[model samples]
Target: MEVMKVLHMNGGRGVTGMGDSSYANYSLVQQKVITMTKPITENAITQLYYSTLPKNLVIADLGCSSGPNTLFVVSELIKVVDQLRRKSGHDQSPEYQVFLNDLPGNDFNTIFKSLPSFQKKMRNQLGAGAGPCFFTGVPGSFYGRLFPSKTLHFVHSSYSLQWLSKVPEMVESNKGNIYMAQTSPPSVLRAYHAQFQADFSMFLECRAEELVLGGRMVLTFLGRRSEDPSSKECCYIWELLAIVLNEMVSKGLIEEEKMDFFNIPHYTPSPSEVKSEVQKE
Candidate 1:
């Protein structure tokens, strides 16, 4: 039977366990974080100089999931801004107001619990005369407005935007697959691509409204180097997972019907897709 398993992945047990299984402590994910450091530093340096320096800076880190990784970008910003302010011979450090945003169901308390250490580290890095740094939690989906118009100076997000806001309609024809797999029908592939396009466009539109005229945003998420959405980088892992799940179905460990309709609401777009969305925005 071709039917949709209307599962809302959000506000589920996944939200609660996220902080525990966080990418912050994972080695592979940490490597990506390291790889991003140079570009982020350069971007901050460029943006800091690209405009007249503001005395009070407003910064937001979108998709700021709970864990050490959540503070990774924020700490980097504090360092860059502090060093630049000192180098420019400014007697006073810029006061920073940082907003950490994520879904309302996210474990923000974990982030809240870790703040003392984060602030202490910031103080230790910036010295005893560090500027006032305040961090606030803004819980909501980034596909819509989270902050006021033209208020943010800098925004950064890492390894988050692969999630679609919702699954596309008419995916029942693409049965027996949990995501974009090698055997996924052309119709299934088209539906997934269409969803990504819609969600990503709205993401850009919302961010454009929130950013200042010259504000900068740095985002790095899952994406394929090739134009093909079903390329190995995008679909291989899900393909393997599907194989395992189907194996379970064969062994009678999982219901065959459940296997037929389950689909993951995640999409890894190609570089061209991202550039197109940015240009459209």
Candidate 2:
């Protein structure tokens, strides 16, 4: 038995991705959100770390993908748990409750399909669940309660919080100015700040509600070089993508009306900005 469990919970991760293009659109959206955490290494010495590191803990992963990527992370987390257990000096195996979570629209069926193989590998290596590993699939918005009160000891979310519910129509409309000049004009940057402020506040409130007191949360979100909340380069990726979309529209690849429809529900919060939000928790 694996006493402890590990998780990469991506709460409310798939909210921004919507519409008739549910398949490809979701992938693109997830990619954009995950890009923020590409450099993440999962430091073992964060403030949220355990003092003795419990050998038995319930772990949940939110916004987990539905393919090889998801399984790979699960394996890595399990490895972490294994390391923690070995130090405990107890030969007794721990019972693991691994929670794989995501949006209701996430490909849960596909994730389940790969579970048998994961279990097989774990059983061969450690000897736990039905065969050797205990695995569980939990589908829901991590933004709210994903588990019972104080049920989880450790939680992790990677490259998933940058997502906002959805970009407001008024902000994305053609009627609004969308230029970000490094010089005199600051409206674009100010608007961007306002947008981030709105979503970031929500993100903080939601996470605070889900996590129990003393429960640690590990998260990696898209960040920016500018300490200022109003940096023009903060969202240059989306701007570039918009330009590309316009090019496609000129070639009749997509409708011009959809230029406003193109949106990635992500916001790169600065360290200070994130710190301020965390203070509210």
Evaluated at residue 80, the lDDT of candidate 2 is 56
Give a tens-digit lDDT track for model 2, residues 24-139. Answer: 33455545544444334234322233453444555666666564456555566566556555665555545566777776656666667667767777767654421135567776
Model 1 clashing-pair count:
0
lDDT, candidate 1, 1-281, per-residue tens: 22112321222123222433454334356446646575765676467643858877888988776655677777777787777777778878778899998877666776777788778877877895568889899977787888989888888877768887776665456666788766778888899988888989998899899988778887878878887777788888888888899899999999998887778888888888888888988
- Candidate 1 lands at a TM-score of 0.87
- Cα RMSD (angstroms) for every candidate in the order listed: 4.2, 8.4
Error of 2 at 232 (Å): 6.4
* Cα deviation of 37, candidate 1, in Å: 4.2
C-alpha lDDT score of every prediction, in listed order: 0.75, 0.55
